[model samples]
Target: MSAQAQMRAGQGASAQAEGKAASKANPIVSALHQMAVSVLSEQLREMFEKADDILFDSAEKARASDEQRLYLDTMRIVRVQRNKIVQAFQEALQAALAGIGEDEAENAAGRLDDMSQWSLEDGDVLEERIAVNNMQAKASSLYAHELVELQRRIARLAEMTGAGLSPESMSPQRIIHAFQNSMRDLPVDFPIKLVIYKLFDRVVVGRLSEVFVGANQLLAVHGIEPSLDAPTPARPESRRAPRGLPQDSGVPSWAGKLDRATMGAFGAPATGGAGMSAMGAGAVPGGLAARQAGHLAPVGGAGTYTDSMLAQDVAQILGSYEHGRRPQAPAWLPPENVALVARMFDAYYRDPRLPDNLKPVLARLQLPMLKAAVADPRFFHDPNHAARRTLNDLFEMLLQFGSAEAAPSPQMVGELQGLIDAMVQAFNLDPATLRESARPEGVDERTAEAFLREQEEMQQKKNRARVERVRRIVAHEIRRRIGERPLPSGVLRLMLSGFGPLLCLDYIRSGVNGASWTETMRLVDRVLDSLRPDAGRHAEERAAEEAELVAAISRRLAAIGFSEERLKEVLSGLLQAYLELVEAGAGRTGAPAADTVDEAATAAAPLPPEKELQGLLSILLVPGSWFTLWEPVAQTKHWVRVKGYYPVQNTVMFGHYMEERFLQLRATALATALVDGSAAPIDPSPELQSAIARIGELSFERVVDPVVWTTVEGRPGQ
Candidate 1:
């Protein structure tokens, strides 16, 4: 037969196969997707029903699980889940459509392009939450004014719709034309639906292009599959000493490609060993119970490689002496814990990205590994042994942390600290250990340095751990309080965890909301009422932690931010404002009407700063376009002590606070509205003067504003 005739027969067969495959697969995928989405939407509808029941019912039974008690919690969880399912639906629909014929997919794409007319997620879900809490007209107005214009742009393309044209005639921007015609009443501001629709449009457009590409290429014209080519796996290197190279006595027996699985992860033979056992297949090592529990006997390759598997395997082989109870461990014995420490050390040594502060901890590994090598009398001359030993030392530090707020373990953080202090001293004594440890043949210098840095980082972490523990306690307390839960532990620890000392200093120096010393004491008293509300109920272990926290905070405050000098200055300024304002209102003896209080004087010290506040709070919750004033000192301190000192909780609380404060100030300021709306003669009392002076003083840093020196200084927004 002729070649052209043979090709025709082959093409006919291929077309028949493609047609049959499409008929089988297309409807199946579409049905699966439809079913999944239907189920998900039904689940969502049920959730909404549950919420409606909660909201409308006068009395409802509480759930036995005590979960999702908050209204916000229920709404948030439901909404987020709905969004996840929505995204999944979108992905599935697009994927299934990709399996359809090219023309059919494009037709579907045209329908989805009309999504610009669909209402997606609404911003009211977030914005309305802000509006409801803002009772003061000032905050409400500010929020209303500082808003995004929800406008929609409908593109109407000019297509040739002249005589003799088809009835389906539409412009090049046909999608936009359809959207405009579909709108009931378009918004004046940026359109949220349009933005989301545009994203979907891009995906469809890409798909359409791919469909065309396929039609123009192999899909339109039959193409042959190319033969496959791939590199063969290389054989494992032969196990033989290098010619003329001296063998190190300590080169461990299972060193090269040692059993991948220790404890059965690598599938090592189950021997009933500590870290080494591969699950025992038969009996020689151990019975069924142990192997099934994953206590594996050490054997050759069983699974994926774990770098530290051998170290643990070796340590188990050495046997557990229970803290050196053996009169004298074998002359060749290494500390069992050293294996863990060595693994940690090796990782740190190999990692160069470690910061400088952590080098001390990284340098700590040399001696432990070298000591092990010396005892074993192997790898005496091998550099790799030295490198591996270095890592062992570094791993010691990595294991320093895992759990939170637990009592310090002796072998992990405690013993290591002492050993580290001693080891560095020895290094200082005889620099020769560097060479002695470096004698292991296979290691690199950079790895050694990385190990050193890792160690230093671990030490820094330990030092910082004290403060972090306290912060954790505080965050837990706040989260618990907001959830209306019982206090978990002493409140003091919760306060001291992260930059805990620094925050305490801020609290001491600047009493909350510019309260007077007397007022501050009163607030503290009220605060202390809850600080130990669950007193005498703490676990013995937790009680010790709380006491430790209180003492630590007290002691650490002296060292924080120049011994509280910053605190006293800010506090003195704040207290004077408080007392002066009190006197201005009611002679400090009589009951001052809330109206008599100079609203500005009542202004809380700008904390967490104005810029941060503006960035955090929505306009709907504030009095003016401006939200919070960023105090220069506070901003600086925030950056220095913590990368972003404004905690999310602080921002939330301060957002609520700013709204209230803005309303108070604006109430009096707005009085000018009665007459020509000119500036009101709001008297600046001494207290107000003090507060303003303090604010300006903080902003200026006891120096003139740099802008004052510039030609454009007086102009706004420069």
Candidate 2:
């Protein structure tokens, strides 16, 4: 029964057992087995490192934690490695079967059904090799599980570390307050909460889907990452106190010392007077970090409280934008937040710096990105204002700033438009109106054809001369009202272009975020206050409202602190209001709101409009009918703006902007009229003739000649 004799005779069970015993007894074999196990673990770790890069975001701080990282890496590698070994073994087995004689192959595979470890003797040494492979695979799996457990330990340590984390300073009491406040603010039956509950309930039924598991797991994993960075000491300050701050003891074994620069900024953070476990006993003010397990325990079941409907709507809008929809247009989007986003973008692009305090919050919100896109000079500098040309333009471009999940996913404009359409639907609007409104923009061939056909019908009733006579009468009537000067004519166009946004306010409110329309109207009223020719009442009403908004801004701005610069900022904001209201006004009919007439929204702040505007408009009881935004040339930023929505370009879209456009139309015609004796010829050369012709035609085309407007005498000539 010597082992060597048994191996030489190895053909039966007794010989096989003897061979196993010899293999165990031999030092050389034992050393080789140990070497193989080490090799397997190292390979698994390497595989995991690659997978981690693909699976999760790279963390600057987390990379240093070798123990935690290595374990996770190994586990990932183990799974891949195990799967690879199985595939190879299966392929080898199949190939072997194919190579065997036909009858032998059939018999061999059949034998596999009843195969045991002992069956290796029947198959020869290949079967024994496969058995060894199985054992190694099992060992790797066990090792991977151990790594998972170790990673869990690191996560626990992260929470225990007393190195207080957050975007701002907070005491333990503050933390409690913040959580309570956040929880209390949560909607009583928020859809997200319900979804979380549903997920939890489904877990018991074993129906939890992979997506549910994945999103929830992602939220849970973030618990270990710091929400905020602790303030670090300045290099100069920390140089003196080289050994100032100590590492928090409860932190993972990998968390060593705070860098020299970070050591002396602030004292260690205390939680409930908890001693520092992150440091050592009696080493810091805080005894230990707050136990985070209590905080992280599923607040509301699985915490999948997100609304699928909202998400779907958002996703659709986002997708539409991705497919080419814009949501960032200043006028088209019309959200105050969108305006703020635009302004923020301009400032951010100009400054290209962010305050440290805001960075953490910025990380959570994707607003910064929209601003960035707006600031991207290469794309945004087009004189055509093409970037946010439409709502779809803004929406589609919004995705560029963040990952898919973090992108701004607005709800569909059409879905919101449904609310606008609700009226047309409910009232059973006429098909003609629908057809008119639904046509494509810029070039409507069908409309042109229809117009041409109608013209032909008119022509059938009368000759070209008769049509010409009617056109002259129409032009004359418009000229009589719009006046006969170019300056006033341009003013008319500017005035009329401003009113559409104010009127569209109602239409916009029908969309999903339109509940804010009331607030917007209030802002608009502040802009419109100075334009009214007279004031009967509601003057006090307007003043009170503007005051309230000012007070609110003051209180909020106070927290950010005040300075001479701050005063100027507030005053400039008011000046913008004045420009939007009194300074921008063109032509007005009714009495202005008394309170808003006297003051801009921030006029009370230091450096009031009177000082800056030289009290020019201040003395005028007129607040005036014509607020000249620009003289000679329409450089809005360079010239002072007069009251009204009429920019140097357009105003009629706001309120009575079209009335001005009408006046400008008339004025343009009159200005071109002959002062018979002054010029060499009444008519200029073809080039000048073409320019004037185009202008006259455009003005005539734009004029409002509704018969009723004619009845209001001096409507344009005035």
Candidate 3:
């Protein structure tokens, strides 16, 4: 038998032995083993029953002879070796479960050794492993909530039973690993294996929720945290403390001062006044507003008339505006506080930057926000206050719909409207409702921040797939073009490692048949040809040809924002390879020492100022940074927020601010945009901050317009 075959057989034998030993040594492992056998046996039986039919259908529909043959062979192997495969899989699972809490470093070292072997003899094995990892990542994301709950329940069960079981034993990574290990000895090709893995993912991993439910039930029967509820998603940690406050303050700098001001403003007793009925204060029992009137009643008040009266008046006035009536602030209420909220909404309504469709949705929040501001002074003082954060999150979510040139989908508009309606209905005197509305616990459907996060995750997934596709295309193209062409090893390495990404970017931006792609391919061929022997050519002719080729290469690299220093290094390497080829043609050994070649290739080169600037901008333009991009042809500016950068594609993804469009710019394109004044970064402060600043610019005495007071008091504006 071959050495590789013998090694794999020994590994399989060792795993089976470990599984048997663990079953004998640990009672917990025995229990888990029993459960896994019963559950997985039934699941695998169902899976295999359908697998043959699936393969037959695929073979019938196959477009190529090779594809049809592959399916037929896979089906035949599965039919013949069904029982053995199942037993092997069960054993692998048992071993994996038993090996929980084992040294991770040991497993990592084992994997490294396996990879080294695969590199030397079987690259298909490495590719299969990569495919499994990608499948596992996708499954983990799709069932994230279920997996988290399962981990929690398993941890609790372990704690109660005095078992050393780890939550990771049931992770997608481990589950996929066991299946891959079982199939390692099968005589199936990579494509067939991938198809089977997909089926396994669908049948086993997709139904992991059922397994989790059963495990939770088992734990509950043992009285381990009985009646376990769905786990709450943990809130992301705050990146920074409330703006303008000390990190360790625990309270805003204006908290105490605001408290004193609030008390003084609402401390006065009720005196029956002419505007009381207009403000809805007369609707209260005994014509005296209580602090606990309803959800809209301001909290933390001493039942004073001014406190509840002010909130009720704001709600009544804003409610009138909904019915096409101009809102008039109550004449007896504190003008400064009323004017602050009024001007804030007015600014929001008038702001041309906000899309027209979103204005009505935002307008619904005026009364809720006013009540929150009255009840909690932190709403104004702390930028990170829940209410302010919630508002900002909503605005950001709406803004991701591209620029005004592209319209948002009706479905997205409906979702936004629904969220606004829900928030308006739930909000009261407390701002916690705003936070809750943004990130609801125990809810099936995500609304504000959670919904946005899911969308961003999906976008990132698509971007990653695009990058992978582009890389595969680039690799195939390079191999096809370099078929059997003997070139210097250093030059080949430079083409693969250094210039490959630039080709990928060109393909991503302008597809396979584009002029840019053709030019890049031609340049690659020229570089390869420059290192070949030209027996009939004069020395000067060869030198001139090499010089022009180097210049062309430099220009191509420089256009992609490569630093001059890096460009010089690359050109020098190519020239050295050319000289070596010439020496070899003269019957002299020409290969440089390995160390010398390594230094020339691997040494870091300093970036030129422009390239350094590009790197700096790439780092700073993280997700959520806003920029205005100028369209020269349209003579218009587009507002976009950075979604992310994909290094493999050399692309930056930007989501438009007013519509549902996304734009991806290559690194060179982005750097050009910045340098040519076509793209400029902008500070998009939170909606509340801009309003507060606008209000600050107004004179304190005339904060409320004289005309508004006159109209509310039943007089002409004059």
User: What are the lDDT figures for the candidates, one per model?
Assistant: 0.29, 0.27, 0.52
Candidate 2: tens digits of C-alpha lDDT, residues 66-120: 5345444443433444454333322222222122123333343344445474445
Report, for all candidates in order, the number of backbone clashes.
Answer: 69, 77, 6
In the range 591-697, model 1's lDDT, one tens digit per residue, is: 64332334333233334333322222221122111122222433410000011122333322111110111112221111112122121111111222233333333
In candidate 3, position 420 carries an lDDT of 60
Q: Model 3 over residues 490-593: C-alpha lDDT tens digits?
A: 67666875467668656654567789889989888777666556678988899898888788877766544354566665666677777765655665355653
**Candidate 2 wrongly placed segments (more than 4 Å):** 1-512, 530-546, 552-568, 571-718
Candidate 2 has a TM-score of 0.17
The candidate that achieves the highest lDDT relative to the unseen native structure = 3
Give me the runs in candidate 3 sitting further than 4 Å from their true place.
1-29, 100-121, 226-718
- Candidate 2 residue-wise lDDT at 389: 23
Worst 10 residues of 2 by lDDT: 674-683
Better of 1 and 2 by lDDT: 1
TM-score order, best first, reads: 3, 1, 2
